[model samples]
Target: MADRLRVIQWATGNIGTRALRAVIEHPRLELAGVWVSNPDKAGLDAGALCGAEPTGIRATGSVDEACAIPADCVLYMRQGTDIDEVCRLLASGKNVVTTRGDFHHPAGMDPALRQRIEEACLAGGTSIYSTGSSPGFVTEALAIPLVSLSRRLDCLTIDEFGDCSSRNSPDLLFNVMGFGQPIGDFDQRQADHVKADFAASLSQLADGLGLVIDCWQAHGEYAAARTAAPIAAGTIAAGTMAAQRITIEGLAAGTPRLRFRANWYVSRDIDHPDWDLRESGWRIRVTGDTPLDVGITFPVAPEHYAAFTPGLTAHRAVNAVAAVCAAPPGIRTTVDLPQVLAHLPAQSSAHSSENLPT
Candidate 1:
């Protein structure tokens, strides 16, 4: 514990690169190695993957090779399906901070995988956790503030409207719009499925609200010529964008108690005369005995990618791993962790690890 927290970053995706930068900036964290699935990425330096100078951290496709590196924690940044490897890392006695698929919640995940990690952490005395922006921090922020006021909760809604052309890949855009052919192709695959998208947030919301969810509903919509906007160029066709509207209803012992709606969109079509802004973000409206509405929108473009917000979410998720490693092991929500907000310097004391329970 005397030296910095040795960290291994696996999966060199956008979020992974963001985590790598964060680890580099963090005085307490040390980037030890990098892991990748692409064989072509082997032998490459981790830092170079982000267009930075090499950090002497070579990228390896071999899990064993990466695990051999002296690391106290592993940052998993792959997609949701990559969670199997994350579990393996956790079972290998390495504390994990992953952004990959799975590990979002304890209730719905495979009991066998959960048991393996539980047993592994118990045996290895390490920790494993998953995090991202929507499911990671925003969900926590919504629930924690609510706990201060009334106890009974009714519904929660989160809407994110951001410029996706800047941060996301083309496939992501297609998925948001549900635009691929054979509708089943995009619908059937768990990776592209909307169920996996809101799983974490809904789970976190239910736990935070102290409600049990029975079932939920998700809807996807896309418009080719919905709206129009004038960009730096001439008038550009809007509404040719993709958008999704999601609703999740929770039940308290089979009685409907809470409901949530989340909407995500790309394209200039969502651009309205009233919302004449450049950047995009989120709007969270929680309706209960006392109504509270808070919206975060960006007027101008930010220096970082829009997806970086999710990266921040992922960063906090991995950071949560360190906190849980200090205590017992189980599925934890934002409320269960420390109440410390982002942009604040991490306190060295134990107070940084304490937050509301789910």
Candidate 2:
């Protein structure tokens, strides 16, 4: 029996809760602590929160308490990032692998903020990185190998199609997303955020390949529902925004090199003439010497969509803990760390831990 990595599950929300369960079940990882924002969740056993047996460790509401717990790494899954809190954990010498979008690319980050995080990492000699399914996986991870298959490159586009019909949140679909609102134009602020968010990952990708992206660009379009359509969230009336596609691109020498397009819709029955909307999945296309188009489909049925969706993000973060911990202290991007490998529970018993690539 060798030493297993001690991991703290920070903030037990949707993705956080999923990470918490994974940390408990993972054979090579041990659950060190659980941090919860909700006061009611505190004092409860960590396992009980995730529908598992009590594991002796209890949830705590205080960030100070979470940092004080001696651990190797923290799987940070908080809804929104708190820089001060994140710095505190790093300063306490605990490495962090987060789903938050803040630390993806150091150069793309605000100069002052990147310096602050780098200082914290240097002070504590720890490492931190951000990753997840869409911006993390589809935007960067999957594209890395595809680009290797080409010499002369024209453009690479990653398309993410999400059918929100199975999502049961009315407020998220209607008010927050403006999905059921009359089609005029997509919100500018959201468009700006989208541009900035995906730009971070794309810039990191370009940097990894020794290519420089001169700038990032964004464009958005929408389609109105042709008729009233019922969804799990609720009913979307006719003449409202039923589908939206936002494309963000990275330019090199004024030429678009890297691109990501997100297609979200409540129904395929929209007013658009040639819009291709389908279930949740990703398609990555490369136009180059070796032209390639790869389609990744999430085979889960509609009823089980929510059940399996979180893993697309959570599992990667959980699996990345050891890789980030072994990485040199600083802001490590997907490009910086070694290949993150998954150590399933079955693998632990069937094979020796030494078999894992270092």
Candidate 3:
């Protein structure tokens, strides 16, 4: 802990706030600066934004200002799909860790954009890492490790089931997810856009396990609300789309070998009994000689689960800062980095021992 990594937290929204807090509380990290999108948030203390004691590190609206600060890494949590700013940060000689979906991997990225990111990394001699709960931990990080035990692997499937009723972002729920639209109006193609990202992870897994993917396919379905469901975004009519299921499959030599399934609903009582439902958690099942099944549950109150997802996303990126900084200059994934362990402060153990009875 003698040489702590200096971290600059970019953006301070739901995910950013959690990353900011983690950076502040981490035993091996130092808060150097913060970048915020809102002009009003500029000059406010970073600790205060995360609801912690003031650390005197003010958030700035200028990306230039944040990048100029002497820091070992930047935890980029801004809300958007843009990777231009992220590449710029890396080009400034700061290792980057982000939850932004676009930079999840360069495998599916546009050639020009991917080249730009590679150029930036080489120019600055810094590395960038991207991870989150779904495209990241649930499918690749969690499921891929389980595949190692398969002696005669047949297929691997990862399913994530959760209720998004409490989600606060109208843009995410209505625009991106098409939650309240009529079942007929929901475009399967739009929903299939995520296939590329999932495919990238599939490719990573295939490469790791020494398998070749012949082709890939994506499918989507929706469930209507049985009754009017009033959510934070708006009211979902009795017949409107209340839930969704998306499946991406990787076929190896005409056989579906790897699949990623996601089921998200407003509530469990929706009119889709056929679709699987879990209050909130991830399930990984591998079919082969030694079949394996693993369930990871996030045992939080229903209302709190909405917030828990973002925290997990942020922590995944924040926890990788050290490993990302130590890695060779380039875009990296969880597969390329060492096992990232959650290292608590020494005082935590000492404090626990002090409370023990003699």
Candidate 4:
């Protein structure tokens, strides 16, 4: 217990809040410091932000203050990717585990930016990793093992289905994601960013399988609501885009090999005829000599989804702290690191190691 890794929680948003509480509760990690960009959040007890018991750690808004703290790892779950801030953390001798989608595949990143990140890693002898529930887990972590069973692999596709009806964030659903907007109002720039994000992830998968991806392609499609539908986020007027699907493919020789499709919908009363949107879950289909189909569903109810979603993304990144800290200096992908061992809390009486398979 005394040898626990000192960790700094670098944000206090939804995902970051979960991570902050997790770092406080994790037996293998010590809460070294906390950082917040919002001045109002600064000077507050770390526990006050995440609803945990006060641990005497106050949040600071200063970059220099965060970097000066001697911590083994920094849990950076900020909303967007701040390259300069992240590089500073890396060069300050603290390994980073982030939920940002940018650093998943270093090879797919801008060559100059990749080199800059690597240089910071090498300078501090630290490592940085990006992970989350969808892009990190269902795509790469789950896809890797399934594809390994195929000696003659053809194509692997990941279908991620999410129901955002229960989410009450109108800004996130309508303004940011362009969900309730008219068909023609779909933002091309946002679509491009989404495409770029998924392309990067799919490319990482291809890189791991040793598949030569000649090109990466991305496509975004939408389904309009046929009638007005009331949901938690608000009403979706008829003819407005209600559902969105962004598919990213890694192709070789003009053939698709690795693919990922994100299916997010607020209402089922839509215009897509062929698409059969499943519940909130994930499906992986591997086409090969030993083809495999797998489905992972979130059993949590819609009302409880807001509370449930953060853990899916935050916990994995928190669990990977040990592996990230141990990794060599650079951007570590799922293939680069060992299988993330989720060291869960031990049971006391009814169930213990005796019940676990050796």
lDDT (10s digit) by residue, model 2, range 1-358: 2789999999988888878888888988999999999999999999899877789999999888888899999998887889999888898899999998888889878899989889999989999999998789877777888898988788998889999987899989998887888888667677778887789988888888887888888988989999999998889999898899998988899999998989999989988868677567888889989999888887776777776777788988999988898999999988877888888786432222223332
Candidate 4, which ten residues in sequence have the lowest lDDT sum? Answer: 349-358
Judged by whole-model lDDT over C-alpha atoms, candidate 3 comes out at 0.81
lDDT of each: 0.58, 0.86, 0.81, 0.86
The RMSD (Cα, Å) of candidate 2 is 4.5
- Candidate 4 to truth, TM: 0.91
Which segments of model 1 are wrong by more than 4 Å? Answer: 80-84, 165-192, 223-243, 251-262, 266-279, 299-310, 340-358
- lDDT by residue (tens digit), candidate 4, 1-358: 3599999998889989988888887778899999998999999999899877899999999989989999999999877889999999999899999999989899878999999999999999999998988789888888888988989889998998988888899999999877889897445565577777677777888887889999877777889999898989899999998999878788899999888888999988899967778888988999989999888887776666667778888989999999999999999999889999877654332322122331
| TM-score to true structure, per model | 0.76, 0.93, 0.87, 0.91
Query: Can you write out model 3's per-residue Cα lDDT over 1-358, one digit (the tens) per residue?
Result: 5699999998898889888887888899999999999999999998788877799999999877887899999888787755778777888899998786666556767899889999999988999877877788776778767887877889998888877776677898887777778787446675578787788877777777788888888988888888999886777888888888888999988899999888888756678787768766888899999799888887666555655566778888888888899999988877778887777666543322113332
Rank order (by lDDT, best first): 4, 2, 3, 1
Clashing pairs in 3: none
Span of ten consecutive residues with least summed lDDT in model 2: 349-358
Error of 2 at 218 (Å): 1.7
lDDT of 2 at 329: 94
lDDT tens digits by residue: candidate 1, 1-358: 3566678887877677767756654556678888887788889887677655568878899977887787778887765455456556666667876655466576676788778667767666676666676655565555467545766566666555545454335454554444221223223343225456465556765665567776654444433425554332233254444343444445556654544445544444542333332346666666677777777764444444443354556557545545655545554445566653333335432211122121
